[model samples]
Target: MDDQLAFRADDQPSSTSPPVWRVLAVDDDVDFQRATAFALSELDLLGGRIELLQAFSCREAALLLARERDIALVLLDVVMETEDAGLRLIKALREVIGNSETRVVLLTGEPGRAPAHEVMRDYDINDYWTKSELSAERLLTVLTAAVRGYAQLKTVASARRGLQMIVESSNALFCSKNTRELSSKILSEIAVLLNLQAEGIVCVRAEEGEGGVAKARIISASGRFRPSVDASLDSLDSPEVAAVLRRSLQGQQTLCLSDCTVLFFPRFQAGADYACYVATERVLDDTELELLKVFSASISRGLYNVALFSRLEEMAYQDDLLKIPNRNALIRMLDMTLKDESKAERVLVLIDIDNFSGANTAFGTGYGDFILGLVAKRLCDAFDGNVLIARVRDDLFAILGPQTQVRAADIVALFRRQTRPYELGQVHSLSSVTMNLGDFTGSAGVALQDALLTLKQAKRAGHDQHAVYDSRLLGAHAEAYRMLLALRDAVEAGHISVQLQPQIDLQTRRVTGVEALARWRKADGSMVPPLSFIPLAEATGYILPLGDLLMRLALQAAKELADAGYGDIRVAVNVSAPQLLQHDFIERFVAHLQAAGVRPQQVEVEITESVAMRTFDTVCEKLRALREMGVNVAIDDFGTGFSSLSYLRLLPADRLKIDRSFVLEIGQVSNEQMIAEAVIQIAARVGMQVIAEGVETRQQADWILEHGCREAQGYLFAKAMGCSDLLRWLADWPRDRA
Candidate 1:
């Protein structure tokens, strides 16, 4: 006992060292318990200290074990107030309380009183030692091995729990839809995964900077740093935390400190950049550091998914070209605003630039984009604070403002405001622009559709006016849409019929050729006016199909005319600009001619001057191809479009068909006759023939012939009629002239 006391005194370590072992001893014998305690104190495993706990009874032992879950080893007496009491307590610890990692060693005064080997196995006790035979050396050896085993098992259990926490955090954080919640969860999970007890902060580097001291914004903070959430990293009161946060962000890697650990989660592919700083007194070993690395990787993946989802949501709700809220976002705004009954007087105004495509033709696409941007800015200015402004189309802008700010007079004043001229390529200046605006009184359902309808009506009314929406406009728009659908059906069903008006030779009074006119005949035997449906066809791109059908019919009729002894006559068909600009248009037209077996000479292609002006290069190429095929090209309604005669020299036309407006009141007005003469002179100078249209009176015919226009077509000669009537009229032309 003296030697053992000396050994323990010599082996005792300093008080500053960590407690490495917690052992429990249970026995009713006071002398044996004292001896066991003294023996444990005598031995030291390096600088590791042992903490001893005593329990005189089985009940006391079970309570102590239950209270101290991390106890490393338990020494039990087989005969403690009852036989096999130690075994029963061990069973409670193993099966009932489920403390499987703690090792148990049994000591008995009587070996026969102890349970058999199978009973010991069932109890899951680690060792069996008779008290009489047990030595100090043997006790030290058992405690050493049992404590070592316990330490290893605790380490493994901690690592497993850490992995489980990481998996749970991944599930929780990945469910967050945006950056805010993702960041908050990251900060909290860092503490939980690492078993941290101190403060931490999560930050993101928001902008690129030149210096290594890049600015980082804190997204979330916990513990003492909770108030620092959403603050700048530079504003943190603790210099150590700020330094570690900057180091993590700039180095783009993990950093370890004495009292804290900083981890960098770089932007995943193109995701949001982030970092986390955890301050704790607990030291991180190799196992914890490795687990943290794995945990951070999972966090980065979840953040990347959240960022990608947010970006997709933004794209879905925002306009790409205008960089403003688009139709979808506008719908959302309307939904929220309309549901709030407090703000009921909201108004929406839709503005459209008049002839924007013409401006694009005048300038380039870049200038068109510039103009749209300018209009967007102007709309924003006009609406001022809290109002929503967006570019809805290439040439359209939408403004949502209070009704007081966007009244009819206010819209008028907005357009009439004096604006500085815009320079084009440092040369040309545009002083002012015109727009049509449509206004609706409420932010209620489908207001944008109503605004668009009113805008179309305003444009049809003329430029530089405001149209207020009403129920009548919706009915009108629906009727117009129905008419368009019916016209399309008409073209498909061959209900579109052609009437031919004869072009007469004024001097010889003989039919020179005929012009084909398209008319829509409804299913109900009612006729739709060409004025009402033709423009609708042009606007809706139905003109292409309608034009193709008309061309085919006219060519077939021309072939019949040639077969019926009218070979000298030529059939003129009007072609739209869209039809001419279509791909493979010339090839398709030639195929139609050949299928009808009509010579190109007997078919004339007529296009309005607007087609030449709008699509100059394409129209010229098509006209040259027509001439190459021996089809004479004529400009129909020439004087009405493109007042500039410079296009005449560049155009490949055989004749200029004077617009009906000039010849409508010919000779009744001196300027009208003089204008007709001037057009004829211009055509003659270009080696092109002159034809006068709408010659409704003999005076108009005589006036055109006096002005050197030899060809004329109007009611004075004959009105447009069906093929049968035209054939009959041609057959009796000599008698009709008499």
Candidate 2:
């Protein structure tokens, strides 16, 4: 051992040198352990000293290896306590603990028990040698080679870790939507790269010469740096860290010091500089240096893009004046919150300042803006980190979080603040208007729309009120939207038609006129009730096309009737109040009828009493012009609406059709009947021809005929049918009294 030593036994490495390469010697032979320890006492390889560890058995060696993570090599006797104890430990090292970097060499006294060739092939050991063959010089040579291999594997493993981190960082860059995310990812990745805990700060500052502390913004932080993440530079809890980063940023280069390191990244835009400070041991070798350089370079491009994203995010998602999130940001938060099923009691509250527009009008826009800013601050203070608050509109705010934190009662109480005069005049309370409990799944924009619609309904009910979004309200709106689309398609595809129900002279039972009713049939051969789609079309302004289609069908029927020797029979087409109030309704009516070679006298403009009553003066003014043009006007479904004496006296109709409701009861029991008779009397005084509808039985027809309704149309005579069917029936009708 004395002759095999490379250096004197007293020449031990100092503590200031790089970390030692730990070698474990596992052998039950105590003499062999002492000899091996002495042989490599003064040796060093790859700028690291060799520190030998001893264990008398495989179990003891395994326990020592478990505690030390950076062990470089293991020299073991093939037969420790058992014949294959060392071999079993090797298998445990390679498979159980997964320690592939540490090199293992097997040395045994009995060469015949384990053949050298087979042992090396069957195990992952780097070298196999008999105890006698491993002299001090040969062991020295083997130790040097094993240490070299371990050093190479360690470098490769570190490089592999760095590469994996780069891949993960790339994904982080790809997934990061804003600067805060990018900054956070960079910190975590750096922590992993340095093999340290995540204790760092990533600060973004303007170019140092441009301005110093004023432009510094701590974007992301973890562990000890977290408290100062949002603090002003002058008031930072970690002022020493800020100082170091500031000095590094001023250098405009990466700062590698003995105590800490600061990585400088100059963003391509915004004239910004980024500095990352990690609290760990000092920098030493090029591998760590190269790893950090590669990281900084890869993330430098990310920094450029992230700066642009930060600016764009500030503009698109954040409100400029109020310095808070805007509606778009709120939408983003809502989408994230809704997707996370683990979060409980998610609530989105929308606050609308009651009569805000009036306040904006009463006070100036400047004062209104001041009030909005106050409201934003108030909401932020009320919820803090518990909820996400946003200025969703000029006078509205939205809060999203757990229901317990984002409570309507709390919001209302916040708004119950005093509305009194201040230095900037007066401001109104931003009352809680509506809330959406996001217990359902959907897009964020749709959720907000439903909330707004609910707020609209609540406003119609009263003011300073808080309401939850009723799914039925959205359902009704969606139904109307679908109905309008279907109605438009039906009109464009010519699926709408006018079915004429024959109106006869009550005395002669002779067909005098036909009431043209609009009908819609779907591609599936199912009939859509007029009661369902008609009101939707009228309310949604889809009535113009639908009404025009019905008018064309009616005129075509009139022309076909005239050609078939039924010229005296008028086709009464029903027109809704919306269609009648069109700017060119009268002109379009005359032109449409005349274009089909059907005279205005051959068509009657029929409207329901409800339509006429709703737009009484407008309907009277428009229909009087049509009546003067020889287009006879008739009031259908009379007495079912506001048929007061004054409105009846002023109604300018050519005919009055009593509703089927009044006529149905006439045959049932007429002991107390005045509605039909009174309608008849009013029509006679107004000089309007009277017709009764829905007459199925002869008794209803006789009762209506006795009550001065000479013209009638019902299923009793003929049901409403297609024009061809009506034409065939008209040709075979009885011209004389039944």
Candidate 3:
């Protein structure tokens, strides 16, 4: 072994001495070995860094090689102690020292002794060089190529291992559901995969207060830096740090510090924004960056999922239009309030807008929406600290407050005063807001439907008012609603009966015709006035059926009167606005008259000027159709509609009835008399008969008669009486002198 080491030293001579390859010479020929070591020493392999090791046999080379692991290349003679001894060393080096990564070059003096091809194929050595071709440059070239190849392979393998770790780490980090947990895992995984010195994740919440404030909470951390935990980025005091963090949060871009790199990923859910930060200082290559990008996308998606789930949960209990708690949320809150012993006293106030439909028509849907939102805002602002407000419908709002602080009057007043005139663009709009208050009076339990009913009564009584709920109010409202239902049933069952007020021709002192009026007599024999129930019927859409019933009754009555020796008298029946505008109303009326076997001229249809003015074209068409059917159409209550004078000429009317208001003030107001006279003159000029209504006294009747009015109807002649009463009165009246 000592001789091998000494010969290896001679193989690589010093530059000032001689060049050598420093190959391990394991030859048994002592003379040949001395000459070969000296010759190889002059051939500088590895820049003369190599040194020869002469064994003079296989056993010596084995002993020397076992002690040295840094030998670059080995050259052995084929005729050593054992021809395969060099092969055994390769195996030993691989198994024992684990030096498989190292390069080994073999040399042989006898080209045929080991057979260069056979040794190259069988051994793990890198190359085969015969003694004759083993020049200094050739050996140097072979050794250099082997060393460079090993270095390249080591680099590739190390890079491959790093990429695999990154991929595994990304997968682990992205699999987490909780954002904080996911962020923590990301930092820890990155730290382990990249071998980072320090790592952390900073999650920023941007929607804390009004207009939003940025607050970052550190989810995970390692090394000496304290985790941000409860500390907000806005409270960081360092302007530069806050600025950078804010920019990262806003732009959603990665930032690099002196020792830390941060990547910002904007997490969006249902169109709202949040941010996630992954930071580390370790150097990352393309593979790590790509892996991090994919991890960021996964984190963003997870955050989006969480946000979406939260939003869906919120929507489950939120009103879509007002963004307030809906009925479900209100019930839940009420349940919670009731369950708590500390929250004993609770008050609920239901607010409703007065004449909301009128307001809707006057302003428009857009303005109506603005008014509703304004009311909601007022309710929210006025009792924000003491009450919770929610919109239940387009015009209904609910307020929940402490019983001690809330009163029925207080809430009613609050709602009434909240409807201040609002400006829409340049237009000024006003809404008459009202509300009904219901308290837990202990007599009647509070119910949502009952409260709504009380509000309905308050609106029906007249608008811009409120009705407090009491047992009496509830009873009355229930009775009114029951009456309405009974009235509807009566009309539906053909139980409605008609009475007629005679129109007396004062000059002749005889009844010319009678106006048909609806009368509702209860089972107790008490009468329900036309004024009392007609408006309700109109509002409830029962007027359409009621009008049809009245028309049929009036036609039958006229036909009966004609058959009973009262042929000249006609029956006039009033038509509501809704009835007049009903589709195919004229055809229906004509069909009814024909079915009753009454001549069209014997029955007159009276439509108020207001209804006629509202749908002038439609009313004209209907009147024209009626005229064509030989039915006389009259414009009732003229001079009260505020209509254009030209409309009176254009209407296809057989007669015009002067409204009672003008007749009442005919002698009181000079302008009223002039207006009434002008209306009569216009009707005359248009070839229409003018009938003065409500001629109650001699003076009024005389004035109307002297004015050349063709007809007059009022209480003086006869009040509206049932059929039997009218026939009895007709039997007592004097004969006509027409």
- Measured by lDDT, the strongest candidate is 2
Compared with the true structure, the alpha-carbon lDDT of candidate 2 equals: 0.75
Q: How close is each model in CA RMSD to the real structure?
A: 32.6, 30.4, 38.9
- Residue-level lDDT of model 2, residues 198-309, one tens digit each, is 7655565543434343356677788876877665555667677778887876666667778788877654422266777777666547887778777776666676655544
Sorted by lDDT, highest first, which candidate order results? 2, 1, 3
Error of 2 at 119 (Å): 72
The lDDT for every candidate, in the order shown, is 0.73, 0.75, 0.63
Give the per-residue Cα lDDT of candidate 2 at 371: 79
Most TM-score-accurate candidate = 1
What is candidate 3's lDDT per residue for 175-209, written digit by digit as tens?
A: 45455565566566656655664434455555455
Please give each candidate's TM-score. Answer: 0.54, 0.51, 0.53
Which pairs of residues collide in model 3? 4-54, 7-52, 8-51, 8-52, 8-53, 19-41, 19-42, 20-41, 22-50, 22-51
| Model 2, C-alpha of 302: deviation from truth (Å) | 17
Put down candidate 1 lDDT per residue, 1-738, tens digits, no spaces.
Answer: 112111123556666756678889999989888988888885675348888889999999888788889899999887777777888998899888899889988887544444233344356776677775476655765676577657756765665465445546667777777777877787778777887754655555555556744567777777778887777877888887787777766666667777777766665432645667777566789888777877776776677776666655555556556677666566677667666554447766666776665666678657877776666665666666767776554566666666667654554455443354354422121111111222333443356555665566566656665666666656765676778767767877989988999999999988999999987788889988898988767765567667888988898788879888898899999898778886578999999998999999998999888887776777888899999999989998887765467777988889999889888757567764467888899999999998988888888888788879999998887889888898899988955542
The runs of at least 3 residues in candidate 3 whose Cα sits more than 4 Å from the true structure, single-residue gaps closed, are 1-215, 218-230, 233-309, 319-477, 489-495, 665-679, 722-738
